[model samples]
Target: MTTHLITGAGSGIGAVLAQRLLERGDDLVLLARSASRAAELAASYDGARTVVADLADPASVEGLDLPASLDSVVHAAGVVELGAVADLGVASWLEQLTVNLVAPAALTRVALPALRAARGTVVLVNSGAGLTAHPQWSAYAASKHGLKALADSLRTEEAEHGVRVSTVYPGRTATAMQEKVHAQEGKDYDAADWIDPGTVAATILHLLDVPRDATVPDITVRPNA
Candidate 1:
């Protein structure tokens, strides 16, 4: 059975993805900021193990102890700070980047040994914002753009080492993050326009379901109007 490590497994798409993976009979490792939430999720997923760590904190990431070998890593942890470029605070900007970009890359680097050993896939949950800029979304766009670059670089660097990287550009997923963005907008964004989190998880599973001789570098899953 494949062992999958998923970050941000406490809520939103991350939680949904974890559920699908668990049902598929994969051993799971859930990493999240809140231990209680992670524990609850773990309990729901056949008592899977939980690791508590803040991805934004470098020391916390560096201190993680995972299995000696991992079949895959679904990097579902991310953050969003909405504001015009001028109004976005430097500190908040860094925090967003830390969680959305730096932490993923750093975590991937740390998990390299185990991933390479298992020829594992790294699933990066990027966003449409990374591909197209929008007003009041400067920080999110920048972080996702950086994350896309990281995925590309890792794919090239790790292929020879037998590890594959997959970057997912999903548009307006019906997640808590999306709700937060909509709530702050003073209007209800069309939930009908949102992509199903389960569908996204299935797409990710497709990326890993490929033959060992094949590789899928990138994919865009958007809700069609």
Candidate 2:
């Protein structure tokens, strides 16, 4: 059975992905800022375990005690702070970059040896903002764009190590984060207009199911408008 470590496993896409992996008989190591939620989810599965780590904190991420080897690592934890460049505070910009970009890179760095040993895959959960910049999403867009770059670089760098890196750029999804974004825009949240988190999880699973010789480096999933 493949062993996978998933960040942001407490809810949304992360939680859905964890459940799907468990259902398929994969062992899971879940990480989240809230220990309670991660612990609760781990308890429901026989071989599942939980790790409490605040991805925004570099020290915390660096200190993670993960398994010696893992078949996959999913970096799904992210924070979105929306505002134009001029009005966005430096702190907010840094926070967005830290959680959305830096943390993933750091976690992947720590997991590199294990990934190499297992010929594993690294999945970065990015967003549509990574490809296009919108008026009020400067900070979020910048971080995601950076994340896209990170994934591309890793794919190239880790190729010889037999470790694959894939980035998923999903459009607005029916997640709590989407609700917060809608509230900030003074718009009502509509699940119909967004992609389902399960759909995205299924896409990741498909990527994993591909032959070891084949690699899908980037995937873009958007709602059908």
Candidate 3:
């Protein structure tokens, strides 16, 4: 069984992804900021382990230690604070960057030892905003742009070691993060029109199923209605 490490396993796509992996007989290490939710999910999987780490605080991720032979990693923990650029608070902006960009990069760096050993893959869950911008989404777009760049660069840097990097850019998934921002903005967006979390989770699993010789550099999924 392959050992997979996932960040943001508390809810949304992360929670669904954890369940999918567990059902497929993958050993897992779930990293999240909430202990209660982590424990709940851990109990459902036979070999699932949980680590409480706040991505906003980089130091929190530093103390974590995973097996030196992890087969895969999914960086799904992210934040989206929507508002006019001028109204964006410094603290809110920093928190977005810390969780979406800095923490993922830091965790990947720390896990390089194990990834290289297993010739594992790194999966980054980015946003369509990272590719194209829109109003009231500056912070989210900027952080996702950074994540995209990091994923691209890491792909080249780690390729020689037989490690692969894959990135997924999904448009408006039905996640709590999306719902929270939608509620705050009062935009009344339709969740049914967005990509499905289960479908996205299946995509991640597909990437994992690909033969080692195959590489899916980047993929974007959007609902068509």
TM-score of 1: 0.95
- lDDT against the true structure, per candidate, is 0.86, 0.89, 0.88
Ten contiguous residues with the weakest lDDT in model 1: 32-41
Judged by TM-score relative to the true structure, which candidate is superior, 2 or 3? 2
Q: Give the per-residue Cα lDDT of candidate 3 at 55.
A: 87
Candidate 1 clash pair list: none
lDDT of 3 by residue, 1-225 (tens): 799999877777888898888888888998867678667767766578988778878778786878879899999888888888999999888999999999999899988999999999999999899899789899889999999999999999999999999999988898888888788788786778777898888888889888987999999988786
Report lDDT (Cα) of residue 36, candidate 2: 77
TM-scores vs. true structure, each candidate: 0.95, 0.96, 0.95
Instruction: Provide the lDDT at 196 for model 2.
Output: 95
Candidate 3 yields a Cα-based lDDT of 0.88
Residue range 34-116, candidate 2, lDDT tens digits: 67776676676657988777877856877678888889999888999888788999999999999999988988998898899
Tens digits of per-residue lDDT, candidate 1, 125-192, equal 99999888899988889999999999999999999989999988998898888888998777788767
Worst 10 residues of 2 by lDDT: 37-46
State each candidate's clash count. Answer: 0, 0, 0
The RMSD of every model to the true structure, in order and in angstroms, is: 1.3, 1.3, 1.4
